[model samples]
Target: MTETVVANPFEQAQAGRPTGPLVQGFEVIIGFETHAQLSTESKIFSRASTAFGAEPNTQACAVDLALPGTLPVMNKGAVERAIKLGLALGSHIAPRSVFARKNYFYPDLPKGYQISQFEIPVVQGGTVSFFVGDELKSVRLVRAHLEEDAGKSLHENFIGQSGIDLNRAGTPLLEIVTEPDMRSTAEAVAYAKELHKIVTWIGICDGNMQEGSFRCDANVSVRRPGEPLGTRREIKNLNSFRFMQQAIDYEIRWQIGEIEDGRKIQQATVLFDPDTGETRAMRTKEDAADYRYFPDPDLPPLAIAQEWIDRVKAGMPELPRAMAERYVRDHGLSEYDAAQLTQSVALARYFDEAVSKGATPKLASNWITGEIARRLNAQEIGIEAAPVKASQLGQLIARISDGTIPNSAARVVFDALWSGEGSEVDAIIAAKDLKPMNDTGALEKIIDGVLATNQKNIDEYRAGKDKAFNALVGQVMKASQGKANPAQVNALLKAKLG
Candidate 1:
């Protein structure tokens, strides 16, 4: 809990990593501040456009720029989004919360301050658990608050100066801060990805890393096991998971190197460069005093009734973890398969619908996670855009299960369905004469014809040569044009050969 910075003025851009510290097994402690943009069509307090890919400044209303006499109007969708996120994280929704102005001045912030929740955040006291390998690590949440996003700064000078793009200003954000519970970079990454999943799954946030829909900042410090906490630095606006991990690692070593070199660490804000994998100092870290947070006079405190909380809870669909567990327990699916099926909400729904329509649980889960997912990814589309409908897929699976088509042929039918130019499975089978030769009488005729044409292979098989048996099966396969089911052919061949 040592928050004071010691006397040091080293540039944070040096890419200083101490090999000795890692070799000595000194650990890095990590914490994260994850910001998720609410998926509302309008700005938090304005009716300006929030759509992406719009022309710059096209969406900036005067309210977004904080012009004189322009009051703010809260977007109900944004508030509901924050509540959904809080409930997903198991946080207690505050019965009442106030909107506060976080005072700061920058070109991107048109108002010279941001309307953010400070000491009294809207939700608090939640825990998020993530898996590091097989072990589950839990991180505690300090608070999740509703806030208006600042405008974007477009770095265009090729110099250090960047221009402002106000199109993004006034977009709503939910800032979820975690306690200092992570002991390494892996834990931080695991926590961040899990949070991203929950927000995106609940349809609260878009979770677009590249577009800055979700951003993460990590605080890193190190100390001996029994020693007091060391000074920490914030690596800001880390947009991707890889950068989040690399930033924590680089920052920890940079601090340790300075401390061991008889230089004290400074508390500051730093930036992570994705290309170079290093952090550069931005400014001294700000405490609450620096922000001068106060309740905004324009907006009243948000009051939540018990009924709203219950309504939100009732509207929630089964979350990913619960659905995964249920799949394993109810359908007798393997843990691996269950996890795969429930990775996405749409995919999980597709799987269950297919199974309910009479596809065997194991087979249905396999197809949805495997072939269906493959087709979806190949076409660069989502399950919602899947060309093959669930009922169609279920019918195809049922056909394969009842021995009307072999597994290999079924894959062809799946591709045909995906390609959209091939006939229906039954029609294709009949037109291509692909009915499997399961009747020993039928397969026996084919096998005998092949053996008569190739007496050389028959002699080799009777001479106990396995390669000859394979050649004979191939000749039978080729004569039947892959119509003879290989399994039935093998059984018929064995009986006749003996």
Candidate 2:
């Protein structure tokens, strides 16, 4: 199960290849199967609460327990949620879809089979497009089927014995499957993030990776360009983006090494050991036929009406892609910047609110993506949890726009605002006395004093040394106690020198 492998020269982190495409030697083929746990109050087929936490089997009911007398009844709300996802993803909602028994036996599966859609899924054929660096990549979806989740097999405690918790059993899930379109681990992660944004944006799923609300299974293989497709191994249950990339990178290197050393890669399921940064084979992979799928006799064919699709469509908010396009077309923001703003609903709202409050689109975009994002990542928080409000940020940007404070002074004010020192941007600037000296006469006096003191720099500048000019600018800023506008200082100094 364990093999010692060297580092991959073509790996993403170490590859040194430019962002657009991989180096010419290898081609990576990747696909994803993501399970987005639907946001429903009850289990898909039973009245048991779908609430995440409870004492082990307390949430399991007769139907979830697969008791002999119990019959499965589909939850209307779950189907509606599925239809909503289909509409959001631009997928087709089938008029009639059949549920099948995906036969499998595990300690946690009380029914020894899972109710899922096989041949005819509820949602079919959609595309998720996202940016990997500056490159725009699109991952095409094969089908998204509705299925009930299996229970967890708890392996901790109890002297070499395992336990089964059926609380998660019958929880509704949308299994989103994609074609093998991704050619790199980076692209795969980008596609995954874009999909996550879409699901959470539409309010169908919370998309919490830590709580197991969303998870991905990545199928990866490597081949020479224009060669036949290589065998793929499925890496299962990658909950975090960090781990997802690590697992795939390791698997690709392992497969490539195996092929190079005259060994054939095997088709199997693998588990990633985050601690060791390696993948271990778990079990042989299963194809659809191995599941022995058959129509579930207990559940009837699920049908959707055109009216329901229209209803869901009418209630749908602006999708991420469309919103990004609008931002680009109307606001003159770059595609990358627009996409970053639209990563989540809250972040997008923050940007929009700032712009509506009179902040320029590009300025708001820059601050949110650069300064704000840097701080948020450092604190390990999200836009919804930011201490500073969007309106406050908008006000600060306004001050910068009107030349009330220079950009340097604005940074100081931002720090104060972020740390709760002051609520208003102007008050912070006033209290700190960080306003730029806007009076041309006052700034000219300071520039003259600096020139009189720094005769050496003036002489160097007259000799055509550009560095000396920058040094004189630095002196002017220092003389003004860092309050002088840099652009204004530059203009006045150049005029005086010439």
Candidate 3:
């Protein structure tokens, strides 16, 4: 079969525009099609359970197996999830949408044709915005449609024969498609993460890459600057974010190398071999016409009312973008900090609770994104599983803000709290004698001693050397055994130098 290449309107608009950074003198173009398994209990078109890890062929009922007398029925839960996604992404939810039969033949597809949305999808026209390392980027989405998943073709266990597991048959999925808008692998991965966050935050999908619940297919191509889009090769089923990045980067380089060697990129689907860090062609990609898509007679067109959409919208939690904006507006956080805090629902909740418990916004942000995040990453746990409670962290931060403890002392208190050696922030501070030396006369004596011993540093400070001033402050802190208030030390040192 001949390869079919589809033109991207986004790329067409980029004609003659200033192109972004190039890979081997060719601009990289990428788009994504992600399949997020709807978090429903039953299959999209059948009553069979959609739970994972079930035995092979056991979950397939008459409707899932396409029995002669059985007819497919739409799952209400799946349709509601579609609405939730549309609302979450600011997409237009079609009042009426149709399901079509995507005709294909595979051993695992007992029905021989997969039911999906084609001509009229349920969601259309949305934008996913995320920061690719400080610079904000937005990717335009074409559509997100409801569909059913096919069974898995197991090839590992049997020798010379493949097994089919129908446990995933007729499972609900939302295939979210995007325009060819990303210019780099970084942007592509960021867009995928943002999309994953939205689907999971809205309770539509679990966003589990390991269980085949969330998967991405990246369409990658490279073309010279200001040229028409290149013929694309799709890398399919990138289950891990790390693998997704590796796969896309490798594909871009390979495409560029092929062009330099006078080879034309073939439109095809490829799989990423994580072990070798290479992508190999699986099949020549097909166009829409190749599938012969036609409305499924077994399932009727889905009709959604405005009332239903409004109901779903009302029940939806505050989205990440909105929460981030609130952080910027109400809490006075930078856009970057706001975005980082809202990476997950649990993390955002932790920040909010900490703030509510009297933690200063910027200080709380610094602590959580800095020390707390480092520890969480080291332990491979979410913020919800943190050893320090939100209230405890808030109280600790309050102590730092109130001049009762220096920032250095706060770390010691934090360590004590995290290790379960102490629970109350105040108790920990008292046990460690972490409270700063608050006595004005005693602090003055310590500062005088530091200034007398560090005469060279004091002389340099008077000669306008800022590092010398910092050295004097450090000397004071050292003499006070790290119990001196840093602000007080800085003020005293500057006065003595003058």
Candidate 4:
């Protein structure tokens, strides 16, 4: 009996895409095929070490090299990693999945064919929901299949002749294919980022695009609103998110312009030139029939047990989406801020630790998303490498909450902590003299001095000029050397002025 494939409504939308207000004139349909290299110690079907950056062919054993008389052996660890990913993504792990020979001729492929899942994949039918701005968006998953990666074809060296590095050959990869649920470049990127976070958070992939651990291929096309889907060109191997967005945006514009000029869009695979900020067609895209897939006789059908799935699920950490929802329900964070904080496992963990250390949830979210993120981006680093500890940040925020220090003084204290000026938050505040002035008598004296000195402002204020009132406030803050509590200053100023 043949299984009937029911198409989802969103998938139908991809067929005859209706342009929303976001893309008013044209329907921009985008899909992603991400290849996330599994975090395994050895290459699939081989005992060869999968360590990256090895000397050419140093890590490839006889099995990886496909020596004559060698038989393939499945790696249990690779399958376990795949199971973990499936559980994290809410995908169905196939009880029995077959591996097939994907026949292709390329210099980088030692076997002249890739052993991959075709008819039935290991994982099937899932949804990856993420926030595209504040609006929640979801991309449907077609399947995630296990596959062996091809090696690199090097052109930089060898003096005009190409060389092959088999080090990456036979590396285990889980190729995750998504439906064309994305309507714009931003949605596509958000989906990619959310997927990346999931894979890395679950310890399945390292999520390193530079080393080709996690790479995205975007299928982009444009058509008139409510028209049939346009011919899509796949942008291959977008390693960076910035490059991914640039490539998709450029491809969409190019396709639209071509259509407007009466040129038919062709289905092809393209490469994004980071330096040029453009995409150029590489080769005509191949259909599934072109690969001529056949079952690999050496390996048996992969069988997964319910016990294994349960074990993997039990071992997994809390997923990002669930944690974000918890933040919304329990901590009273907005969906946008919750999503921002959960961008990475480390960031989310940092936020939770700060809150556990007595930092207000909303305030902690603001500092992490705003100031800490700014510094981390400027330094070109991850939150895990931040100099300030979560507890320290919590203490600083607590100071702000209790009128111990104003927001301005908190910033100064944070910079001091980041610069190693002091070990403790309170010590930093003391050393920098950043404590807010809470003494009523001292504040009264300061305000009196400000009012006495700014007689011109006083006259102007009596004349009903709002600027004069602001000027007096500024003078009071200046007189107190930015240590006065802004709320206290405002209250005292209104009382004295009246």
Q: What is the C-alpha RMSD of each candidate to the true structure, in Å?
A: 6.9, 6.5, 3.4, 2.6
Model 4, position 119: C-alpha lDDT score = 84
**What tens digits encode model 4's per-residue C-alpha lDDT throughout 37-131?**
99999988888888988899798777777778988899999999999888887888888888999999999887888999988888887889999
Model 3 pairs whose backbones collide: none
For model 4, the superposed segments whose C-alpha errors exceed 4 Å read 1-24, 452-471
TM-score to native of every candidate shown: 0.76, 0.93, 0.96, 0.93
What tens digits encode model 3's per-residue C-alpha lDDT throughout 20-109?
Answer: 688778899888999999999999988899988877899999888888988888899999999988988888888888889999999989
Q: Lowest-scoring 10 consecutive residues by lDDT in candidate 3? A: 1-10
Tens-digit per-residue lDDT, 16-62, candidate 2: 22222443366788889999999999999999999977999999999
lDDT, model 1, position 338: 74
Query: What TM-score does model 1 achieve against the real structure?
Result: 0.76
- Candidates 1 and 4: which is better by TM-score? 4
Root-mean-square deviation of Cα positions for candidate 1 versus the true structure, in angstroms: 6.9
- Evaluated at residue 89, the lDDT of candidate 1 is 82
Which 10 residues in a row give candidate 4 its minimum summed lDDT? 1-10
What global local distance difference test value does model 2 have? 0.88
Off by over 4 Å in 1: 1-28, 129-138, 157-162, 181-190, 221-231, 241-265, 371-381, 384-389, 420-423, 441-498
Among these predicted structures, which one has the highest lDDT? 3
At residue 82, give the lDDT of candidate 3: 93
